[model samples]
Target: MDTEEKSNQLELETALNNQTLYWQANLKLLVKLLVVWFAVSFGCGIILVDWLDQFTIAGFKLGFWFAQQGAIYVFVALIFVYARQMKILDRQFDVGDDDSNQEPQS
Candidate 1:
């Protein structure tokens, strides 16, 4: 192969590797957040409800709070967390909302 062809092939391989790494990082973050949501919503709300009920929060049982309100609140918080984390990840991967890389429109 010519030098230019070899150079293009190397660039392609590098881009593919970077894409794979970015995807793996994204999935890792997703799995971690999901596990936290599952533990709060299912583990605290249902599986350990009886145990958690022994505790109180603002005149409500902890388990009931998880089932009724806490889980929803946590999920919302997780949404923001995901957004912020993804923003950081995007910056890290040089992938999103980067106006500096764009040409000015006429």
Candidate 2:
């Protein structure tokens, strides 16, 4: 019932809200990246291969290239993209382990 206690409770509530929002954002980013990964790896590589095969690239069928190589490249690129995005997300959430700039604890 004291003013200090009420202020502390409000600060805790705000922090919890911010943490929840950060997690929600992180999950949404993860889902979106997974969807793109699935679409490239499975959709283009398998389900739509027949349609894509009608085109040719460097003496290889587009569908075959996608099924064999293009998807792998995309997956690798996605890994780097995810890492970069997560770094930014970590900064946004005040997480991760770059501690040189932090104040020393007593």
Worst 10-residue lDDT window for candidate 1 reads 97-106
Candidate 2 segments exceeding 4 Å error? 100-106
Residues 1-106, candidate 1: write the lDDT tens digits: 6999999999778767876888899999999999999999999999999999999999999999999999999999999999999888877776666686432222
Candidate 2 deviates by what RMSD? Answer: 2.9
lDDT of the candidates, in the order given = 0.88, 0.84
TM-score of each: 0.88, 0.86
Residue-by-residue lDDT tens digits, candidate 2, 21-105: 8789889889988998998879998999999999999998998999999999999988898889887876776654568434222
| Residue 91 error, candidate 1, Å | 1.5
Q: Least accurate stretch of 10 residues (summed lDDT) in model 2? A: 97-106
Q: Say which candidate scores most in lDDT.
A: 1
State in Å the error of residue 61, model 2. Answer: 0.6
